[model samples]
Target chain A: MSEIELDLISHLSEYKRIFSFLTAEDIMKKELITLTPENYLSEARVIMRDKRISGIPIVDKEGKLVGLVSTERIIRALEEGIISNKIKEYMTPREKIVYFSPKDTFEKIVETFERYRYGRYPVIDEHNKLLGLITKHDILRAILKQFHSIYIHDRRREEYLNREVSILASDKFIEDKASFRYDINTQSISEAGEGTALLKKVLEKRGYHRDFIRRVSIGTYEAEVNVVIHAGGKGLILAFFEEDGVVVFVRDWGPGIEDIDLAMKEGFSTAPDHIRELGFGAGMGLPNMRRAADRLVILSQSGKGTRVEMVFNLKEGRD
Target chain B: MKLKEVMNTLEAKIYTGEELLEREISFGCASDMISDILALAKPGSLLLTGIIAPQIIRIAKILDLSGIVIVRGKEPMEETIAKAKEERVPLLGTKFLLFDACGKLYEKGLRGT
Candidate 1:
């Protein structure tokens, strides 16, 4: 079971204690660097440099967060023009602003931080006046406290699971249940087939990035085509994602590659002449997938199937 | 030079963020490669690039670039222009090639530090 579920089951009472200790207002930094919209971009840079901050709240005369200014905006202005004489010229105006209040919970703040990838958020009062700022560092500190609590709760959960397991064994003949089943197959082929489109759609639905999905889809399609035209049979392709990364296994049961190392070279395809005429095969499928995936492993036996397993890291913070 | 003056000098069209043209920038970098511009350009610098793609505007958004100048008379697609507009990033286009545009700006005393 996941740590979160374990905590929920074994430490329901301690959860309330954890909640009571973490309030949004407790983590906010009351001091913030503020700038007026009338200031020049150079002036904002100075403030940012002195404050050692990447972003600053742009305020009006009333001290409300009218917008935000960052280093990126400064660089953009210099490229667009030599100089921007005022902050309003380059300041990102306040629209779709996400702010937090002191009354909000730490969990909600964490959710917001994760969703937006914001390093810091401006804290506002009831009048929408800027009160302070809550940064990722502050959130991290709060989460650390929760982590400690979770650790203790997890220890208790292990004890509970142990006790439950003992009780289950005492009750004998408990049925074993299978939650899900997946069938994997591998084959080699040298021509493109109907499965290419189906595999592409499946990977797309599984939430791969568009660029990566395209490259993998093309690579897999080429591999399939290679199996049909050169290897003379369909290749096998299987993939599953674990917490650590995605694992894909492809194999071709056709006549095995004689020179695996030579075949791995770029532009080294054994595709038949007719397959080459279609402008689909360029002898770069294996190399392309190798470049795209975090790990690539291949095993082949003479006159037997060739197996290829590829693993791609679940890129952090992408979700 | 102020952004207003640069816009006037280039006779460029502002597709969006008209209200922000009065801002000031300190330096400038001219490049077509997004990665290079992101790495080399300092904060508060203007970016001049000849590449016209939605990815350009998306890069501007990620880097929080104040504005983008599309050179070589290349106009951004309508969707790209709209994305820039929505992000409140000013978009400008000029007929001059990359080198000449940078040179003219340099001649106009917009030297990078």
Candidate 2:
């Protein structure tokens, strides 16, 4: 292999080792709200809204994580006028899912998040039985908790205090980023990437690196595809350019995602066979968006709409 | 290998960018799925697909692909050809099936990305 490739592998393995000390069992949420495939989409939607959660794990009689239903599926069903349909018709089935075992280390989970960009992952046993759920926030909390102990032991209190002050002071200098908005017409799948293409051009004109532009385009394109395939084919794209990164907010007035947690799961798609035939609806759209963006947030209301926000942090000194 | 060699190996016909046949190509990938191409394809790799829409051409541009091969003797739409030309991406066609086309290229040492 080439030297650069070898260097990357070594760096990745070293990074993995640093976080391998903590496993999924250490940080996953043991308590979870779950449903069965026999449940109706309306029921799942109600549960997600009332519980203030974005997803629900669909379990079988054995409590296996057989499927998942989230707000994206709910919004899709609503758009199709099938809100009353069985959850089985809308849930992302188990075969396409990516799950983890309790023994999986934080490094593996972190790498998976970086690659898939899912909002949360289910921790299952060898038999595929649901155990707990883990999110990026949970991982952060665990890391922070670890740091607290390290700080207590190292006697680096003054240095830590000074670092925190510098971080807050740096935030004050970030000016209000310029914003741009565009109307997305999802009338045709062939035209789906246009909105993001425009964004790409704008970024390129500003002299951003091709790799950075590629990342933004991929994330924005996936968001655009979601709007087209699930959001009744009409939406809006809002972007803000920051000195260090870019923020994108994709909005749609169609049926909102009723359970976002399920929607964020990799391979959890609600698209029909027709859309699938076109090389889409593989349930990787959201994950792809997540993988490309440094951070992602989804907001939705059942009858109102859904808005997806993604932030991309650019590497310094590359441009 | 040059794209010209790939065309010769598959008995392909150029739909556009005949002047650019001398471009160097090192990798190949076949898929009808756009997401797969977006996620798996490497820069400058050649795409083998049966899809005939203008979207593929747009994707070719966005991903910086070397070119696209419309396999299975299928022809791309006029709009697709036009877009490929506008984007300066080579568009080619082959009478060989997708599998056979890929096999022929692989035999000639063209590897996948």
Candidate 3:
């Protein structure tokens, strides 16, 4: 097999082990847009169309989860001339559905996904109250986040990069040791990867191995985009090049993550609707960064800032 | 088998990149989940699915798929069509159901890689 293809097979299988370590609650969409069974069918239809959501939970007057109204049901209703009816008349009632608890892991969920072919499953607690929703897209995003842990930084890292750049540059008759940096504007997601893009091209041009370049690029891009989506303020990405790998430090000043433990969990995110809709937030960014690098260290102060240091070792398969 | 042969078997219409159908497909995959395809589809395979969204093109790009057959006669959004055209990924629509289209391709020598 070609080296790149064989490398992908090894990497993807390794990712399967890394990704199976989480439960449903860690990634479920907590801020829900729901419907009431008593509400007219038109309301659900409007919300689905407007929000680009395929399904919405139906709740009772007391906010207990009751059922779901999916696009399929709506289409069936439209064909049957039931659009004027209340959601209770056509929604898939709770008792007949396949739902998940907060404790179910992706290993468990993948079976359901493959067996049922449903687009999403609602997440509930012991009381059977709807806590949030988890979709195929969410699970996929979270899992694939691990799939590409290809890799990237810090003070020791800075020194290492300096040493490598100087040595590598000498071969080309250049003498300056330079560490790369980029300013990440929280509001400028469209431009978030400008730094990482150039960095990858430079490394590739410098004849780095394909696997090594991908690891550094993916890690740096994730860190850079995380700052743009979650940090709530301008941030900076600094890259260090070493002989064996790359290190990146994503430092941001903002309302820092309150719980580093919680933040490190896959599918954890506090990004608002604006960022989520723009496809920036799936709660996968940090865990992805963790897996991308061989060694990862996070430093943050609540109401202050966060600094994420990542190390990518070309020889190591995964941590 | 070539993507063009699969197209003729399913009686599908090329929505974008018609000139590219003569290219050979290394394999065939049937899935609506973009993430699964992105995570697992081998490069240069043919993807057959019922999903009609722009995300399909992105997944195709990530996997470097040979082409896509949107089964069940679903038309993608205009923007999705535009994206496929720009990305140079062949996108097609078939009147046959997803299972039937896949079966036809399988019968005509397309196997999952």
Best candidate (score: lDDT): 2
Could you give candidate 1's per-residue lDDT for residues B13-76 as a string of tens digits? 7777789889886787777643345344554677788766655665554344557788889878
> What DockQ does candidate 1 score?
0.01
For model 1, the stretches where C-alpha displacement exceeds 4 angstroms are A1-21, A144-319, B1-113
Worst 10 residues of 2 chain B by lDDT: B33-42
Query: Runs in model 2 with CA error above 4 Å?
Result: A1-178, A317-319
**Backbone clashes in each candidate structure, one number apiece?**
41, 8, 6
Model 3 CA RMSD to the hidden true structure, in angstroms: 25.2
The digit string of per-residue lDDT tens for model 2 on A178-208 reads 3667789766887888888888889889988
Mind giving the per-residue lDDT tens digits that candidate 2 earns over B53-93?
88888778777789899999988889899988888999999
Please identify which of the two predictions, 1 or 2, would achieve the higher DockQ against the true structure: 2
- CAPRI docking class of candidate 3: incorrect
Candidate with maximal TM-score: 2
Which pairs of residues collide in candidate 2?
A: A54-A259, A54-A260, A54-A261, A55-A262, A70-A259, A71-A257, A71-A258, A71-A259
Using all chains and alpha carbons, the TM-scores for the candidates as numbered come to 0.31, 0.58, 0.44
Candidate 1 CAPRI grade = incorrect
